[model samples]
Target: MQLVLVRHGKAEDPAARPSDLERELTTTGRSTVKAMAKGLRLCVSGKVAIWTSPLPRARQTADILANAFRVKKIREHDAIAAGDLEVLASDWRDLDPQPKALILVGHQPHLGSWAERLTGAVLPIKTAAALAVDLDEDSALSGMLRWYAHPKVLAGLADR
Candidate 1:
């Protein structure tokens, strides 16, 4: 299975919101989304499916990427959802997709932890950044890391 992990765009400072869940993406965050979308549109040339955190920023970023890809397929996953990392890894480890590719849009700490838990490697999942892993059919949750795309790199695609 091919897994793509996307960290949600930068959001408003949590202190300004009543709850972290309510904090929306910043203007720069939206730009980041655009960049991520632009980047994906260039690389990974294939049909794509999207999964996202319920958070506005993540959902919004998914929206941007979905639009860019002309892909309407989107779902919500608790793995990236403020839940347990080990559990998410176990569940996702068993999916056969309806889309040509899989993209997961979510938040940090959980995203970072799940990535490490699944890949057995520590890599920073920066805001709006995405990492892609290639899993052998028999690969375990802690499979080998393939390659990843940073939002900054994707955003750079716009200028090229």
Candidate 2:
């Protein structure tokens, strides 16, 4: 299966909200994500499932992707917000019909960690950046990085 890891778009200043989970995407962030989603749509094909952190920023990013891909359901899971790869793997194993492609939208550092774990590459996951990995059919944990795109690059691709 293909795994696409995305860092949530730029959000309000951390101090602007009492809870980080409540912080929302800035106007510019939303537009950037929309363009990035267009680029992402160009790269991925087949049925795709989107899972996102419960946090507002991540959820908003997932929403944009859902629209871009015309995906009907977006799963909101704590494992994504908590960045628990173990739980994510267990949940994925439990999927009734695993999708051909999966997109995970979440925060940084954690997303970067996941990329490193899956691809053995030290990736710098900037906000709104995305990395694609092809997971081993035998084990979800094992995969190779297919590509990594910064928000700027993806937005540029959207113009094509």
Candidate 3:
């Protein structure tokens, strides 16, 4: 199974939002995510399952990815929220047949930590960045890092 981890895009300044979960992506964030989405489109084929945190920024990022990937629906899961790695793993296990490719849009530290836990590699994932892992088994810790694309790198690729 192929799993893709994505960090939510740059969000409105914390001071500007009353609640962290209410923060939305900034203008630059949307543009960068669109470019990253373009690059992501080149990486997979067929139906892709998209799971996103209910937070506004994450939901917005998921929307960009869904549109780019032509995904029919995006599932909102509290498990995908920041710092919920264990829940995320459980959610993965609960999927019936499992998707050929799964795109999970969430926040930092957690995304980075999840990537490391899955591939056994410490990957620095920036906002709007994505990491692709190929799992030999359904286990969260049983995967190889196929690729890690920073938002800048993906944006550059989209330009090519």
RMSD of each: 2.2, 0.9, 1.4
Model 3 lDDT per residue over 23-103, tens place: 999999999999889988887666699999999999999999999988889999987785777777777777888888999
Q: How accurate is candidate 1 locally (lDDT)?
A: 0.77
Supply candidate 3's per-residue lDDT for 149. 89
Score every model by TM-score. Answer: 0.86, 0.97, 0.93
Worst 10 residues of 1 by lDDT: 92-101
lDDT (tens digit, per residue) of candidate 2 on 3-33: 9999988999989999887999999899989
Between prediction 1 and prediction 2, which has the larger TM-score?
A: 2
User: What's the best-to-worst order under TM-score?
Assistant: 2, 3, 1
Task: Please tell me which predicted candidate would have the highest TM-score against the true structure.
Answer: 2
Off by over 4 Å in 2: none
lDDT of 1 by residue, 69-140 (tens): 888677777667775655555666556643446788888777777677778778988888888776556744
Error of 3 at 35 (Å): 1.0
Model 3 ranges off by over 4 Å: none
Tell me the deviation in Å of residue 5 in model 1. 0.4
Count residue pairs with overlapping backbones in model 3.
Answer: 0
